[model samples]
Target: MTIKLNLIAAACENMGIGKNNNLPWKLKSEMDYFSRMTSKTIDPTKKNVVIMGRKTWDSIPTKYKPLQNRINFVLSRSNLDLKNCKDVYASNSLESCIEKLEDNAFKSVYETVWVIGGRHIYEAALKSDSFHRLYLTKILKTFDCDTFFPPLPTNLKKVSDPDVPEELQTENGIDYTYNVYENTQFGK
Candidate 1:
């Protein structure tokens, strides 16, 4: 069975992801969009995995560290203890992590696995041929950020956007678009 990888993130015009370990904006619409996109119930036959880099995990608020109801896999070189986290695993390389997950038979049961990130992990996913869909929220603003999402791949095509407002522009002087791309297009 093949692994179905998905990405969920927001980025600035410069692809900046975070500033001072926080999101650049607190748009309610963006939060709603994120919740709607990621709240699907996990398929029991398949395992749902959320992969993130070390810094990204640290960036998450202490209250939300152990994101509820899904397996959390962290990619880190350091031997940090992740308390209150369920099914926590760590790896130095994305490939090795994926291999371990596969070896443990994670894909056979889960319909979709997500690569939730904080910049570096997103870059790794973009370069690899592992993902099937990219769920991005382009915030219309630039921030002083140390992390950023990588550019979208040309091969993917937009598939859905039910909530994007017409003529909607971000308060930060950037024009944003909500796009979903599939790895393969069945027809024009």
Candidate 2:
């Protein structure tokens, strides 16, 4: 089965996504947008899935996770003990996690699949055949970041999304815009 997954993240002008394994900047609105996008589901009985690298999962504050109302999948090569983690699944690779989602038990439980990231996970998601759309918060300013998002493929074309406001958004003296990009090759 073809699983179409969306990638979501906020990046500065230099494509910087993080610093010190945490968000380089915090904008409540941006965080709210992420929460809304990943948690929203048309079917009340189903929940969306958020896939992330183990580092991304670790970066999240304990109080805010397993990120309420969504199924969280953490990918790690090492055996991460998550048996005690509620609403979270640990998988060795994105493919393995996706395979689980394809299983009969999960097929009807998940409404959508989203890749919320770390550098390498984003890189892998972008190249996956399942890659569909990207919801990117483009920060107008640059930041000093040790981790960066991968450059977008030329095949991705900007698309408008009603959930995303077209007007520029400003927060904490910084300006940014919401951009939705679709893979033209995939014909969504």
How many clashing residue pairs appear in each of the predictions shown? 5, 0
Give the distance in Å from residue 45's predicted Cα in candidate 1 to where it truly belongs: 7.5
Question: Where in model 1 is the C-alpha error above 4 Å?
Answer: 42-47, 161-177, 184-188
**Candidate lDDT (C-alpha), each:** 0.71, 0.92
Model 1 scores worst on lDDT over the 10 consecutive residues at 164-173
* Model 2 lDDT per residue over 55-98, tens place: 99999999988989999999999999999888899999888987
The collision pairs in model 1 are 45-109, 46-109, 46-110, 47-109, 47-110
User: TM-scores, in order shown?
Assistant: 0.79, 0.97
